[model samples]
Target: MTTQPERLQHLLDRLLRGVLLPEEAEQLAGAVRDLERRADVSDAVAKGNLRHVKQLIPAVRAAEARVHELEAEVSRLTAGQCTHSLAICETHHAKPVPGCPYPRCVAARATGRAATA
Candidate 1:
């Protein structure tokens, strides 16, 4: 016979797959809250053995830290590229820089008159 947790897990799985009955939806929520309380684990993670879950915490933290670092790097690179493009746009004085890849810059260059000294 399946245990309550197992049945609750099955219900939760069905709920996640969009197949649960209306009553089962309520049941799934209650089961999830109760199990989460009992396990003292994050709701973000639905299911795992205790040992594995414990092991994953640090790994998850590390991966999240790495994600933050990469996000910062991406932001910095994008800002730098935008600044470079803007500078080039200003230098060319509304014209596209000869080798600049921005289509708007190219359009501006095509339409813009030469800058007066």
Candidate 2:
């Protein structure tokens, strides 16, 4: 059996040639109405999706702002603390903490070249 699009094309071609039978004309009209109904449903679905996204925007923005605030609080709390790993200070640039076992931390303390926060 031919697909709906193919059937529609055939009917359209017959109509254009001015040789479409009454039944074929009815089929063409039905296909056009079905296409219009599908378009209307799709438009309604899209509008609904847009409304949902609009409703979510303020909540999303508020959550993002809270995340930024928490990050800032973490930064404030961690200020003046060593940011390097306990095992190694790769850059040897982190602030030295007393009794740290890492050689870089010891060397930085000895040389007084450790970075200050």
Candidate 3:
């Protein structure tokens, strides 16, 4: 027997190939509803986790503050370094540099225009 996910994939493949029959359409709808239900449950669980984290934050306030300070120090130390490499052109307001291997940069260089923010 096919799992819900497998059935969903099959239904999607059939949908992409042609119109679904009435029963197939109903099946697809059911699959979509099931997926939505799962997503809702996941969202609720995430929200519960977030609430738990928030409750614990006060207990770890000192540690959290130290972490923030360390993060700031690291940022200051790396300020002069190019962390993103050619992905951002420092001279061009963080736009991709011309001749950059990234597709957007290649397209920009081809058009003789700097990428806009």
Candidate 4:
């Protein structure tokens, strides 16, 4: 049987050490449940589009994944030449034009042309 002051001191020490009694833990859990019950995320959960809300994390993640794929495809296609002046030859000429910027131009120029450049 502890004195009243000793019990209070022990309780304070336990609290300072981050220890909670069963009743304290139960009360805290109940308070948290109440807060969650009253919390207002219906707009996010109901809208379902994740627009203009904190629930857009999954949507943003999906968009970022798509962007990564597109970026990878662009990198593979251009090999970092997407920014340069590359064009496909629509003329269907017998030989590629000299100094053309297309990747296949050199091969096309060499195949059927006798030009040495």
How far in Å is the alpha carbon of 82 misplaced in model 1?
A: 1.3
- Give candidate 4 regions above 4 Å deviation: 1-52, 80-117
Q: Per-residue lDDT for 83-103 in model 3, tens only?
A: 455434334334434234555
Ten residues in a row with the worst lDDT in model 4? 79-88
Q: What local distance difference test score does each model get?
A: 0.65, 0.74, 0.68, 0.57
Q: On TM-score, who's better, 3 or 4?
A: 3
Q: What TM-score do all the candidates reach, one by one?
A: 0.34, 0.67, 0.50, 0.25
CA-only RMSD, every prediction: 14.6, 7.8, 16.3, 13.1
lDDT tens digits, residue span 1-117, model 4: 977457556666666789978885665566556657756466556666545565777898999999999866653444334224443343333345555556455666668652222
Candidate 2 segments exceeding 4 Å error: 80-117
- Write the candidate numbers in order of decreasing TM-score: 2, 3, 1, 4
TM-score of 2: 0.67
Rank candidates, lDDT, best first. Answer: 2, 3, 1, 4
Model 3 collision count? 0
Steric overlap count per candidate: 0, 0, 0, 0
Instruction: Assess candidate 4 and give its TM-score to the true structure.
Output: 0.25
lDDT of 2 at 56: 100
Ranking 3 against 4 by lDDT, winner: 3
Query: lDDT: which candidate is best?
Result: 2
